[model samples]
Every structure is written in C-alpha cells, then in structure tokens.
Target: MPAIGTLVDSFDDNAVDAVLWVDSYGTYSETGGRARVACTDGYSAYASAAAYTLAGSSIYVRVYPPAAGGAATAAYGQVSLLSAVAGTELGVQVNAVSGVLRCQSNVGYWDAAAVEVAYDPVAHAYVRVSEAAGSLVWATSPDGSVWTTRRTLATPGWVTSSTTVQVRLEAHRDSGTADYAEFDNVNTLPASPSGYAARKAGLFLGFF
Candidate 1:
C-alpha cells in the first residue's frame, strides 16, 4: 500500500466498503493528523454463539473524508463490531474520526459461515439466509434448490423469526450509520468457523 496521505482516492464516490490500501489504511483527519487505532475495547472484540461462532479477518483500514470537508486531511480507518455477547456478533463496522480509528460496537445479527432458508414444518418458520449488510439474501427450499421470494433484513443489531431470519453471516459495511464507517485493528475478531460442523450445521439438521 502507499504511504500515509498517499491519496488512494478522493471522497467523490459514494460510500464504499473494502480495504482501500493493500497494506495500509489511509488517514482521516477531523481534528489532527496521526494514525491511531481506537476502540471501545481495543482490537479483537468478539461474540459467542450456542451453534456457530464469530470470527474476523485481519483488520483492514480505510479513510473517509467528509466528502466535502476542506483542509489538509490525512486520516482514515477500518471497521469492527460493537457488542461482544460471548454469543453472537452481527456486522461490526469500524471507522476513523479525527485520526482515531474507532470501533463500532453492538452491530448485531447472526453472522454465520453458512446460511440457508428452508421451511420448518415443525415451527412453521420460513427461513431466509442473508449477509450482515442485508443484501446477499439466499433462500432454500426443503431441497435447498427451489426457493420462494423472501425479503432482505437490514436491521442492524437485530435478528428475527420473520420471513427473513438473521442467522447467516457475511461481511458488511455500516456506511449509513455514524461511528461505523472505518475500523482500525478493531476489525480483526476471533474466528468461530471451526464449530460449524458440530455447532452450526448440527444445529440446523437438528431442526427437523
């Protein structure tokens, strides 16, 4: 990645996710110019689950200027979660404000490795799989093939038993919300994918 203040791109495009720099998070200066990682509990705050677990990739940082703010800006960041439930963490978004990359916590939903929407003849619950961002909705039938039309769930920090359940997980961005724009090292969390076979998948099949 380029050095600090190397100018990845201007704040012309609309809000976007993905690491801007391959090896570096750009700088965002609301108050000053100094690269720093800030969070509620530092980096690597994670959640827990009875079935699946939570995990995160290496923290990726990017800077987002006011898009209209004028001044010598050299600030940026990465993103992460808000609450560590020791159970579940939805889509945790992080961003930078004033040179401090703050971690956005409590962004919940059920982020899982694999998600499929199937009819629960027992509970009568129609399932809907989706990403933490609310897009990327995938539905499955009793056969995991033919699917029905279901809506997407975009409610952050929320999961439900409605048509679209919030169990499956995928990476997402919290651009619409404040304090969740860019994350620093806070993006990296404990990966809980290992329990998929025993916890997650088993939990699924168990639901006759």
Candidate 2:
C-alpha cells in the first residue's frame, strides 16, 4: 500500500496552490503586450513563506507574453513542481503559462491536488473561470500535453485511486503587453483516461 501520512496543503485562498496570482506587474511595453517585474532576468524568483513548514518549499513561476511580438511566445517552458503543507510528501508542480491556475499537484494520486489559475487573453484580459467563478476545468490531457474540452466528461470513469489527477489551466495571450491574469478557485479533479476524450470534450461519467 502507499505510505500513510498527511499529504500537504498546496497554498491558501489568495494563493495559487496558496492564493490568487497575476502576470506582468508593470505597464504594457510598446512591443511586448505585458511586462513583469522579474526578480532576476526572467528568472522565477522565490516567494518567501515564513509560516510554511514544508521542506524545499519554493514557488517556481513562468510566463506567456501576449501573443504579439516575441517569438518566444510559442516556446513551451518546462513545469516547476513544488511541495505543499499537506504532509511530508512533495507533490508534482507543473509550469502553468496559459490559463489562470498556473500549476499545482498532490502526492502522486494518494491525496487530493491543489491548483493555481492564470488566464489573460488580450481579447479577454481576465481569469477564465466557470460561471460560478471556479478556477478549474474538469478535463483530460493527452499524455499530459493537451487537454480535452469541458463538456466531454465520461461517467463511471475517472476513478479516484492513485491514478486520479488534476487538470490545471495556464493563460495564453496574443500579445506581450499588459498581459495579466487572475483566477478564482483551485480545483482537485480526477483525470479520466478511458471514457474521457484524449484532448476533446463530451459527456463523461466516473467516480473520482
């Protein structure tokens, strides 16, 4: 059986994994639609959390400039996984660049996951959320690269065992200026592989 212990809480309400997050804290550049005040030269800085007791606790972040100027817009950045306070276990942290919740995870599949959100499309420069203002979209990813649509979830599927997974959203833009996004709820969802579409959407059934 899997090890038994506390899984660890990713973050708090205003915390992506912890609370809400955004992109580009400065004014919009004439060329780049957005401009973030990076701690270093485009380096994901460490956010101090004095109260957090998790080992190696750090926040690794990435960005997606508005899809306008820089060719780097298409460059897919690697994910940054982190540890939560649920327990001693370290959850996998993925680099989120397109939606509202950037990245979040739990101890493999033994426990629930905590997610971060970020969606700042130039056309819609706000966090993408459900009508109820939830930050997660219950969907499936094809090999952890692409996600299925919102309506195509299968039933009696998406079991909540070890394989259960969370579908995180990253924000994408068409320009690089004023690109800031916001998120609402960090979700803990199950990934349906069989009944769910590989990267599409439809009716779904399962017990996650």
Candidate 3:
C-alpha cells in the first residue's frame, strides 16, 4: 500500500508542475505566490502533477475564479483528481462556475453528476476530496476549518490499487478573452478528519 502521510504544494515559491495547454494561447505560470492559468484563447489548460494514490487519500486545494474580462461568458477553473493524465482517464472534475462548485465524475464515456456547493468567486474557497470510506467524497470550506460535505460517489472502476492518479488545476473560457484562475495550497493527506485511520487500516488489511 502507498505510505500514509501528507504532501502539499503551497505555490508560494512561484513554481508549478508540468503544464499542458489545450490551446496554444493557454498558459500556466506562478504569480504572487499562487499557481495561475491564463487561457488567452478561451480554450482549456491543465497544470498537473502526479499525486498520492487515492486508496486512503484526501486532496485539498484553494481555487479562485478568473477575473473579469472578455465576453463575461462561461469562464471557470477546477480542481481535478484523475486515475490518469490522459483525456480518457476516469476521475472527478470539481469545477467552479457562476459562484457555485459543480462536480462531474466520468465512468468510461459517461459523465455522472455530483452535488453542487455554494461558492463565491470574489472570495477564494477551499475544496477537498477524500477516499477514506472506499468511495469518493467532496467537500468545500470557506475558511479551511469548517468543511461542508457536498457529495459522495462509488469509487470509479479506473481507480484501483495498480493505477495511479494526479492532481490537476484546470482553466477554461468560452471566448477568446483574457482570463486567469489561481490555485493555492494544493495538498494530499493520507486521511480525513474522522474515522480515516481506521478506515485506511481496514483497506490495507483487505489486501492481505
């Protein structure tokens, strides 16, 4: 089993992981102690890095929506955890749009909707996902201390012991207007608040 612990990237060092821009105009960079994505062409861009396995993991990040620009059309950013890095991977996309956090988990070629959370773009929001109960749990917090549960889903088939996962920061715009999103305090923990240690222990025991 993967070691149980916590790993975090605060982005205060002005650094980011490998960047993949879906549009030539899209760019990823670190500015003002945060990882930022500028989708100049209104296309999509993902700044990603390999993260801890999900078997007993809780991933956390703070996301800020794009600043006002362009058509004011649909422009958003997301915190994603996926079984793989490719487009074909099965995982969850936690997208923040219109002051709300929306979740979509893909299974094979289908998309499953999870619950939504009230989020304010003007103010940064703390987002988290945990796999402590052998399933996926989504939550959000205003101050990082009090987290509100959003949704839960059965573990996707692609998320298995042998398959690895990644934490990704994504930005996209519907029009060719300059907009950017920021990400901060990206983290992966071995457990969540309650019952995680025991839950993880049972999962580890199951492999024997």
For each candidate, give its TM-score against the true structure: 0.19, 0.22, 0.70
Give lDDT per model, in order: 0.26, 0.26, 0.60
Per-residue lDDT, model 3, residue 104, is 60
lDDT of 1 by residue, 184-206 (tens): 21122223457655687778888
* Per-residue C-alpha lDDT of model 2 across residues 1-208, encoded as one tens digit per residue: 1111112222322223222122222222212222222221132321222222222112112233222223233212212222332331222222223333232223453334344334333322221111112222333232323443322111111121222112222233333332322221122223456543743343433322
- Model 2 is weakest, by summed lDDT over 10 consecutive residues, at 152-161
The true-structure Cα RMSD of candidate 1 reads: 20.1
Model 2's C-alpha root-mean-square deviation from the true structure amounts to 16.5
After superposition, which runs of candidate 2 have C-alpha atoms over 4 Å from their true positions? 1-68, 73-80, 83-178, 188-208
Runs with alpha carbons beyond 4 Å of true place in candidate 3: 1-6, 17-26, 42-46, 49-51, 68-73, 85-97, 108-112, 121-124, 188-208
Off by over 4 Å in 1: 1-126, 132-140, 155-208
Q: Per-residue lDDT tens digits of candidate 3, residues 1-208?
A: 3421254667666655434222223577778988787745455445344544766677677778774355345567776665653553333233333555676675453465645555554333777777765687777777666777777878665554623565567777666457688777766322344588778888889999
On the 0 to 100 scale, the lDDT of residue 148 in model 3 is 74
- For all predictions, the C-alpha RMSD in Å is 20.1, 16.5, 11.7
Leading candidate by TM-score: 3
lDDT ranking, high to low? 3, 1, 2
Give per-residue lDDT, candidate 2, residue 192: 56
On a 0 to 100 scale, what is the lDDT of residue 41 in model 1?
21
